[model samples]
Target: MTVILERDCVIAGGGPAGMVLGYLLARSGLRVSVLEKHADFFRDFRGDTVHPSTVTVLRELGLRDRFLQLPVNRLRTLDLVVDDHRLRLVDFSTLPAPETFLVLAPQWDFLNFLGAEGAAFEGFDLRMNTDATGLIIEGDVVRGLRATGPDGDLEIRATLTVAADGRASTLRDAAGLVPEELGVPIDVLWFGLPKPTDPPPPTIAYASPRGMVITIDRGDRYQSGMVVKKGGLDALKQEGLPALRKHISDSATVLATVVEALTDWDQIKLLSVQINRLEKWHRPGFIAIGDAAHAMSPVFGVGVNYAVQDAVALSNAIAGDLAAGTAPEATLAAVQARRMGPVRKMQRVQRFAHGRLARATAGQHLAPRWAIGLLRASLPVTRRFLTRFIGLGFLPEHVDRPVR
Candidate 1:
């Protein structure tokens, strides 16, 4: 027997976007159901960055202090090694005091924290192990969604449906809303290496003629990612794991000794990079946000933050309308309007970074030495721009109405 349910809003994907949206809308006194396909939030190599923009949202929600209580690494600056010159690219310290640095926590821990907080609201329903398989559309209007839950098939009819299901969104596909692929030239291979007893300075990335490697400090282990040309992982594997190890070691000498920990090919995980966005974000009773709406690159680790921002913008835009049982297509389009500018700007930045990375992965320097020297000379100006650009992002959204 199919179980029928109804809510003010039904959100697919309990990621940063859906979870935050659910929390926000529920707190706004709107009945919200969030569907998570997974029983638990334990996905590894996911975006773990809780940027300053997100911190402000947390502050608005009165969860900032509690969020800080979690085990997290505070990154003060983003240091990048371009060839032989190590550049302090972005300095979060320059931002406003107290909540200046970027927070790096396990994505699962963040999601769990959010889920727990959202549970406090009477209207928030987070359904675990529930896969939102298809949209319930009736005559060009998305009525709700059909899901396969722990028991059996479930039907959730809602006033407004949100597809936050991620880049490969089932709902987005079902709605026939395709994202325009903004070509990305590089993909990343994620793996962990044992941290040395006397670790190197917390350098975030290293780029040279060899390739680009990201090094994240995770207490005992270095959560690392090696950037490769898009669709080049198979060739990299054909070259053997030893070649992979050597390439990593050569790019970032700090990992030379630790690269031995990667003895097997299975240790590496490939993240196929993509930058894409939907031209039209809404139909009649539905809208898409987060990765479902626009997939971002991992350039500045803004994926999580941007998704959260989307939720903030979305909730602020339509929480009232949703609570009143009518979030018209115009209001949904307005949410997209409020967010589309930032998304487009950031995607441009990501695409530019992708071009540079693509060239670097092909044994080319990121930029001319003169350009690097010029940037170094203009540190004061560049650092401030980067701090705001990466930390707060463009047109950062805030929670508008008081939570019920």
Candidate 2:
């Protein structure tokens, strides 16, 4: 039997975008329902960094201090090491007070935090173990969604339906939103090795002729990723685990002994990173945010944070309309208009950096002397630019509607 539910807004996918919007809009006193395909927030290989953009939102909501109690780490500087040369690329410490560094909390911790906060609001309704199957449309003006949960099928009708089901969004597909793929050449083979007993660097990457292996300090373990050619995971696997182990060990010598811990191939997750954005983020009563609207590359780990920013923009644009139960298509359009420029600029930079990585991985030698020299000479200028871009983002959102 299909369960019928009604709300002002129905959000598919309880990810950063969906959960944030659900929480904030409900805080604004709008009825919101967030559906998650999974039963629990725990997931593997999820984006773990909370960029300052989201941190600012938490501060605005007065949730930052409480949220800080969760298991978290700080990444103040991102260093790129090529052969014997090391360059500090993006430094988060340069950011202003109270938001100087990126918070490296697991995505589940972040999601659960959002879920709990949303639950505190009387207008918020969160349903887990629910998979959105298709959009509920009435004569081309979209209305809500039909989902399958543990209990049974659920039909939710709302003033606005948001597709946050990620890059392969069923709602986006059902809505016929086409994406422009920006052909990224790299795929990531992500796995974890034991964190070195000694103090580890905040975030470090070892780029060699074989490829690039980045290791982020995940408290007790080193969350590692090996960047290989697109569709290269299979070929790399065919070479066997020993070959994979050697590559990782070479990239991170401190983990040479630990690399043997990965005995089986299944432990390594192949992330086919795709960077794309929809030509249209909304059609009528439906809106798409986060990965559904624009799938980002893992180049800079900006996925979750960007999604958070999108939620803020989206909530700001349509909260009142949602409350009044008359969310017009124009308000949906405004969210996209306000956020697309930043997405385009970010993707352009990601694509350029992607090409550079591919070239560097295929060939030997570090970045050119002139390039390195330029980076060194312009450290201060570049530092401020990148710190702002990654930390606060292009257009940071504030809590327009805070619950009294």
Candidate 3:
């Protein structure tokens, strides 16, 4: 038998974005349901860096302490290198509140925490192992969603529908929202390295002649990622472990001492990097957040952070509208108006950074040296840049105004 559920908001995809939005909306007393296709988030080598700016928002929600209690590595500084020279850029020590550093934790753990928090709220309902299939629309307005589950197809009617399904969002495609490609091509080679007895400094190492290696401490151990050219993973795989290891050894000083073997290759995971922005982020009563709306390259590692911030912005906007008894259409417009500028700015910044790093030969040759100099040259500027990436810059008067 098929089930029919009704709610105020139906959020498709139970990632960090959906979960956080669910928590916030539910806390505001709105009936919210989150439908996630995956039963669990135990994926490997996913995004794990949570910046302090996000931590500040978590603190506002009273989840900061709980977040800190989770298994995580606190990184206070970012290390950049080209050739033999190394520079510490964007040291978290200079930033205020929740610590200026980034917290390293398994992405699953963070999402799990959000899910748990959402579940505890009286107005929140999360449906796992359920997939949203299509929109329930009437006259160009999204009124609900159709989903598939164990029993069969289910219909969920809500005032609003939110798509947070990730880079390849089914809902976004079904709704026919086209994403604009930013044209920056970069990929990542991700893997886990055994914990060293004497740990090296927490750092993001850019190897000259092309390649980026980020070493993140995961409490008892460390995880690392090397950035490679787009569609470059196949070539690396063909060249095999010796060549890959040699590449890492030659470019990165921190990774030089890390022993490599063919067995280690088995444990590494790879992902292609892309930056995408939707032509429009909102419809009549349907909207998108996170990667569905804007997928940034992984250069800055702000993907999750920005997604969480988006959730916060949307939740706050919706809450304000609901409080004023605004219509669903009006609320959606308000949300878009509040979010579009920041989202656009974020996309532009990501594009710039990705472009600087996307150069095949020249970038690979000059990146490390340039990065070292850039970081070493200006401490204040680096701190401000990191702050901006984390969503802590001046807002326009319109975005700053409280929803009325």
Candidate 4:
């Protein structure tokens, strides 16, 4: 039998955006249902950055203390060696107290932490292993969604529906909202390596004419990703895993020994990085946030952070109308309006950053010495900008609405 459930909001995708949105709305005393397609958030190679901006949001909600209880690595610096110039690209240590640095935790651990928090709210409903199939429309208005779960078919009716699914959102497609894609010069290949007894740098990267390789320390393991050209993975794989290992070792000598730990092709995950956004984030009764609204490049490792920030903005924008059981397009547009500026500025910065690296990948040439000189000259000015932009973003949103 098909189960029909009703709530003030039905959110598709229990990702960072959706989960945070669920937690916020439910805390606002509005019944909110979150549909998660995955049985659990155990997928590897996902975004795990918990930036200072997010820390502030959590602190506002009184959840920061609990989140800190979880085992995580707090990285104080972002150091990268490009063209033999060790640039302290970002200094997290420079940020203000109680919010300095970024926390590195598994995406699953963070999601599970949020799930636990949402569970405490009487109005937060999380349907695990449930896939939201399509939107239910009545007279050009998005009323709710139809989903499939372990039982059978499920339909959730609500005053507002949200698409937080991810870069490829079914709900976004169902609503006929298409993203205008920005060109991505590079893709990424993700793999893991055994952490050295003493790591080189917690968050570091090695760049050469070959390409850029980034590594993030996760205690006993180093999660590594290499930037490659568009449609570059298959050819690279055809050359086999040995080529991939050599590629990393050639650029990042610190990872030489451990790069071989990735023995099989199946072990590495490919991320076709893209940056895109919808022309309009909402219709009358439906809205999209996070990656559903904008697909972020992984360059700054801020994808997860930006998504969570979106949740905060969305909750702040529509909490009143949601509680009153009517979310107009203006309220939804306010969320996008609050978020779009940062999103645009960040994407612009990423394009410029990646554009330089993309040239190296394209030509198999070395990192330009002039570019290095330019980077060093700009460091005096760029340091503050990079630290703030990458660590907290431009204007972080705070939760001001009172929750029941």
Name the candidate that leads on TM-score.
Answer: 1
Given candidate 1, what's the lDDT at residue 343?
95
TM-score of 1: 0.98
RMSD per candidate (Å) reads 1.3, 1.5, 3.4, 1.8
Candidate 1, residues 6-26, lDDT tens digits: the string is: 899999999999999999998
In candidate 2, what are the lDDT values of residues 12-59, reduced to their tens digit?
Answer: 999999999899889888889999999999988989878888888898
Residue lDDT tens for model 4, 97-122? 88987899898999999999999999
Q: 1 or 2: which has the higher TM-score?
A: 1
Shift of residue 351 alpha carbon in model 1, Å: 0.7
Candidate 3 Cα errors over 4 Å, as ranges: 261-265, 320-327, 359-363, 367-375, 380-404
Per-residue CA lDDT of model 3 for 1-404, tens digit only, reads 77898788899998878888888888888888999898788888777888776777677777788988998778777766655566665667666654566888898999889888777788899888889999988988888889997678989988778999999998998788989987766777787766555765766755566455666677775677777777877888899888888776665555556646325667778777878888778887788998998886666677777787778878767775654544366666666677667767777877776665665324455445565566667856876676455535323211223223
In terms of lDDT, model 2 sits at 0.86
lDDT for position 84 in model 4: 58
User: Candidates ranked by TM-score, best first?
Assistant: 1, 2, 4, 3
Which regions of candidate 4 deviate over 4 angstroms?
363-367, 377-380, 401-404
- Against the true structure, candidate 1 has what lDDT? 0.91
Mark the 10 consecutive residues where model 1 has the least summed lDDT: 395-404
Query: Can you give the TM-score per candidate against the true fold?
Result: 0.98, 0.96, 0.90, 0.96
At residue 366, candidate 3 shows an lDDT of 45
* Candidate with best lDDT: 1
How far does residue 252 in candidate 1 sit from its true spot (Å)?
Answer: 0.4
Error of 1 at 241 (Å): 1.2
Candidate 2 stretches with Cα past 4 Å from truth are 402-404
